[model samples]
Target: MLSTGGVVVVLAASVVVVGSVDRGATDSGLTGAPSTTATTQTEVRRVDLAQPFAGTAAAGWQDGAAGVVVPVPTPLAGFSAEQVAGALTQVRDVLITARLDPEVLYGHDLDRLAARFSERDRADVHTNKGYRTAIAPGSTLLGVPAKVAGTMTAKAGRPGELLVDTSYAFAYAFRPPDPERVNDPLHIISVVRVRTQYGFYDDRWDATGLTALDWSSYSYSVDCAAAEAGFLAPSLGKGGKPDLDAGDAERDAFDPAAPMATESTC
Candidate 1:
């Protein structure tokens, strides 16, 4: 359990490896490759907040909720095809509401997101410090849409439960209070990779609704101070670069297929 503002949210300490039944490819259009091709000479261009992803790995990622593509649902051992489909849809809705919604991200409002969880889990959703990426008070996101790319899968859990797993990388472009002062795109952009497992229970389980059973995430190019205080602020706001040493050296924050980081690398 992780404590946030004196509230405890039960989060898995390690990644959950659920055996998945292949239901064909998902609607996600990711090619598992960087959108921009590498060139012999690096091109230098001025950072434009409006076109924040112009020169980054997320340049071709889908905008906002479009990236969360649900896979075709198939019947599991104890679940019907319709049940699987409904679970997938519900999970997708939760992901969009929790991560991509401007109200939750910029306004720090969790009402819509918390409503997606079971009654028992709603409080956790409301109080979990890292559950959502909220911009600091002094800064605001640019009008440009956030870049997203990820995959969703489903599997059977226990006897009458469905487990939907989602993994995604979200890139947000922030406009500093004084945009003219920042010159590098990395300083104004932040990437957050989230991996979550949502459990849907039937009559057998005491709880009969959906709950986020596990959660893990990692953030890049963000201010350590804001992150510590449970807010997302670009590193440029603090007059420094991201603390890369806190994260895995080989991991790329923009890669959806990359493993989910267990802890925040602020």
Candidate 2:
């Protein structure tokens, strides 16, 4: 139970979950044996995004992710964590049109090509994983190869509502930008994957036919002083809601079930 985003529930079987809690004891607290209370009761109090849940503070959160679409986005149902870091920074800036070579995603040797990724490509790891309190971390972008820093709980539902409990720092840097910075670039926080997802779904599949391929290279150090200061405030405030699993627990961003060969060897 590690909810509040940064999920870590290890069940690995009967999927389907929406998020209120069995992952931690915050906002929605209560586990086993208490489902039979009905004598004029009204205890459904799990809607506290640091209180005032009705709206306003999200300020449409810039709506920068371009109406966020993963499984659905026609009506704008969900997905916070700054719109999944702004649609993964437009999917790492459209991979700069695959111009390749950010030093091949800057060294940290997952053992030389690491059999080319697959257990969901490194079972979701994040180093230099910052974005809401990864505050400065040397202000990112220097030689990418960061690891062992945490914060990544990306749950998905509502045909994938897109959840994102960020804060990373497994950074790297090869810094070879000058090929016109790829003509019209924007590499805020960075990441470049090489190959996986069975090499883009058995070879060539797009339009959501799967193939996120997610290579094991990473980037993204966008910290214009933590975006003008609003790191979501110590994980939300006004008191009474702070234990989003409290710390360091892993997986299950919406029932991961299996994907842990000791944390993705590929």
lDDT by residue (107-144, candidate 1, tens digit) is 55788877777776677767664567777788788878
Per-model TM values vs. the true structure: 0.77, 0.18
Which ten residues in a row are the worst by lDDT in model 1?
A: 7-16
Query: Superposing every Cα of model 2 onto the true structure, what RMSD results?
Result: 22.1
Query: Top TM-score: which candidate number?
Result: 1
Candidate 1: count of backbone clashes, pairs at least 3 residues apart or interchain? 0
Candidate 2 C-alpha lDDT tens digits along 1-266: 11122211120111111112221211222333333443343232222212211221122221222222233222223545555454444333322212222322232332222222233323221221111122222232433222222223344533443433322222122222222221111121221112111112212212221113222221122222232221111111111232223112112221112222222110
Backbone clash count for every predicted candidate, in the order shown: 0, 34
lDDT, each prediction: 0.65, 0.24
